[model samples]
Target: MAVPEDWMGAPPRQPVDLHTDRPHAARVYDVLLGGKTNYPADREAAEQTLAALPNAGAIARQNRAFMQRAARHLVSEAGIRQFLDIGTGIPTSPNLHEIVQATAPQARVVYADNDPIVLAHSRALHTSHPHGRTAYIQADLCRPGEILRNPALREVSDNFEAKGSHVNARSKGEVLRFFHGLDLVDPGLTVVHRWRPDTVEVGAAGWSDADIPLYAGLGRTS
Candidate 1:
């Protein structure tokens, strides 16, 4: 499963000198996902994390599975047809748009990230279904105005109608706060793997919240 060197894409139009000396969180996550786009620093950081938590890799995969499950539920059950993903990491198989558009072929998705490496691999994010559409923007969450100003994001936003929302929170309190004013889907906020797990993909250990500390929920305005 060796990818060609050119798959990362041609050089950026603007100079995006990477800070390869330091470990970036996204690249470390890429390493955890078994992706080859990370640097030695990222690998070192990932190794350190694994040393402390041996199940980190499994946890990463489970988190990804949770995303796919959530996206599928929104499309198949809630009738949502658009998505705006912020801080999207490296291009992983079965991305949000891929999962959403699979259920609703005409669904549209917009991905925004601050990492220059993600911009280099933006082509993968833009691979839309013939009927659906996808767009990627290099914007930081800290600067909300920049992402809000992008025409593609604006166009997609203008056409959106809220049917439901998916929230990922670091703490149980944060997760509860997000759903405070809304009615949660069956089985409110819970550990990511327990939300709607594919046991074939995640093994017996996935049932334990201790291995994965993230919380996920889907809710709708009542």
Candidate 2:
């Protein structure tokens, strides 16, 4: 017997409990992103979410766009050359590295995620530029100490660590708390589509907070 072609390159390392019977947030997100890496359960969950929020898919895309815009700004304007992305879900195109490294090929990025499935698909995250580098660590976001201690993340600078989080949603006050010890760049914690909103596209001119309920901000250690 032979496996179907669609089943190729689908298994993760070490055979962790995927729980395909249930919907995983990451996979549901993947589904919303129009990626085929999700299961039936994940699609059903995504549909439910869509039903509740008709623009959920648009919000997802805008959320990713916000990260790209922020990363580009950090690289082109802020002179940031190192990055640490937490909760990096499935391999999405024009990833953080792809965005930053495009402007500064010497930029280094370390993606951290606790999902075993993400670990299995980590290979896609490693296509760093020859001048730069990218690494992935299978770690939980709740354990900041462990991630900070990981050698893969510490190689660039033991004293310097730039963290980026791609979360679903957060209240204005709750989101501000993340930058407690850092000085926020101008126009802090605003709606995602409002941040920059540079790229011209259909309906881009009229995107309101109600259209995309995601927030983005940049902070620097003082």
Candidate 3:
């Protein structure tokens, strides 16, 4: 896919070094999703994890489904047009940008991940629509401040004119900070499954109010 024209002048391309010797979380996820972008070590690690917990793949899928639904809600109902998604895994169909842009073509998205493989594929796969904007940054979740401060990432947040349209980070501290300056939607800062549980079983199996690996909620910036 061709790079979007808007992103063409954004920044210089960073070198991506594919480390195939060890297992990476993004590659493991790709293997679980049956994508062809993983190494042998990743497949081996993923198989071991699956053996230990059969529900691992289901959990990943559920997380992804939650992300899609959340992005859609932010765009369609909440009227958010800017997103900062960190720990973004491999480029899957209906990515964050795709979901939001589909609902509102003016939506802007900034995807960040530490994995080199994800960076490479994201560079190729995350093209924006003519009017919308999409950009990727190779960064780690541990450095939330750095990611938020990135020039490319800041551009998306800077463009938001509405209260809820600015960049919202996806970590525990960041999520809290985001909500501190904003009003969370009803049923605030819950686990993914708790946001809109599909079934009783899903709710029972996935609810974790204390320490959910993923924290998601919609809020209007104030």
- Candidate 3 clashing pairs? none
Q: Runs in model 3 with CA error above 4 Å?
A: 1-14, 154-182, 198-216
Give TM-scores for every candidate, taking all chains together and pairing residue i with residue i: 0.79, 0.81, 0.73
- Stretches of model 2 off by over 4 angstroms after superposition: 1-13, 16-22, 156-158, 162-170
Mind giving the per-residue lDDT tens digits that candidate 2 earns over 195-218? 776775577677777688777787
Candidate order by TM-score, decreasing, is 2, 1, 3
Flag regions of model 1 displaced more than 4 Å.
Answer: 1-13, 20-22, 142-146, 160-171, 200-207
* Cα lDDT, all candidates: 0.76, 0.79, 0.74
Give residue 216's error in model 3 in angstroms. 4.3
**Candidate 1 C-alpha error for residue 193, in Å:** 0.8
- Candidate 2 — which pairs collide? none
Lowest summed-lDDT stretch of 10 residues in model 2?
Answer: 4-13
RMSD of each: 6.4, 6.1, 5.8
